[model samples]
Target: MLWDWGYALEILPVLGQAAIITIEATLLGFAMAAVLGLVFAILRMLGPAVAWPVSMLIELVRSTPLLIQIFFLYFVLPKFGVTLDAFTAGVLALGLHYATYCAEVYRAGLENIPRGQWEASIALNLSLYTTFKDIILPQAIPPVVPPLGNYLVALFKETPLLSAIAVLELMQTAKILGSETFRYVEPITLVGALFLAMSLVSAALIRQVERALGRRFVR
Candidate 1:
């Protein structure tokens, strides 16, 4: 009665499906964050006119709570006739919220590059695109991979918040299972185990990436 193995087995498939949704949202959201972060970082480097506004936007996002942002996207946006489904709203919220932190990470990476590198590129008459693509990003991005990977793991954990908007991620699925069977222990414990397993796997992958980058850049 304390723990129903049979019930846990029965619910495993459903939870697995829901876990896939969580993973999908995390991946999609992190991809958006990575791209947007890089763009924001690059734009901020352009001039005071660009950097000031971009800095304010990044600060605004970082200062606010992600749950409120999620609610605004899912609940309030419908009032403006720009409606999004629960999953889309959740993924967007996650992406936008995390992108601010990622922007800071990228900015730090870019700033760490030596001033001489920029001068060298300019002296060589390299186009801005060529400078960044061939020289700057190759140096800036590798150093930031570990931090970006940390954000990826952090974003994955945040997927449980999607339940607030009925996105039916892992936590929401566990909650539904608990309510239906009146058995909270098995479902909730399993959800914790699943999250832990996934986090460890993600950490391992991040380390592998770091090693590979180290080798590539070591010359």
Candidate 2:
């Protein structure tokens, strides 16, 4: 078998296109995580009556493997007559799986907030909405961004699992190319490089956000 640079270059175009699928799944999943995490965080903060169910759900999701969740969504939903495309199923599973972790991140951020701040909110007669939005969220969210971003990057890496359901992504493209060509070295190595490059780029961007938050946090 020839170790072919031409072979590697040829597959890049196909992998480049499939990388979009990975990115879309990652971003959409993060979007869901961000919102659901916030909701869970706030619900928990309010009181046990409001918090217990969401907390239980977070635990349930966290205890389950993401691969299992993805498989269930892809295979089981059809029984209920709910149809989902591979991309949607992949993203939804990724989102739901990560939301549990994101909720914990949010919980940590909220906990890091000074008890004095809550006392201050209480003393001021500020409405709950105003108190959370104006004070707690502003303080909590910035610190949580880096952690959340890391989860998003994790989600990005997990997109390869979508191949199980035939959602075309970078790794899937590599598999296809390898199957057709019988040369895995080039295609598989390209997939690794793509994941590394994307993860590095995303980490750098998140570092910027973290630095910006640092300035605000210190002030």
Using lDDT, give the best candidate's number: 1
The residue ranges of model 1 lying beyond 4 angstroms of the native Cα positions read none
Candidate 2 clashing pairs, residues 3+ apart or interchain: none
Off by over 4 Å in 2: none
Error of 1 at 201 (Å): 0.4
Candidate 2 local distance difference test against the native: 0.88
For candidate 1, lDDT tens digit of each residue in 165-210? 9899999999988898788999999999999999999999999999
- Write down the TM-score of every candidate: 0.98, 0.94
**What's model 1's overall lDDT?**
0.95
Pairs in steric clash, model 1:
none
Per-model clash counts, in order, read: 0, 0
What are the candidates' C-alpha RMSDs? 0.9, 1.4
Query: Could you give candidate 2's per-residue lDDT for residues 1-219 as a string of tens digits?
Result: 556898888888899999887898889998998888888878888888988888888888899888899989989998999889988998889988888888889989889889999999999999999999999989888988988998989888888999998889888888988899789999888899989999999999999989988997876
Please report how far candidate 1 places residue 93 from its true position, in Å: 0.7
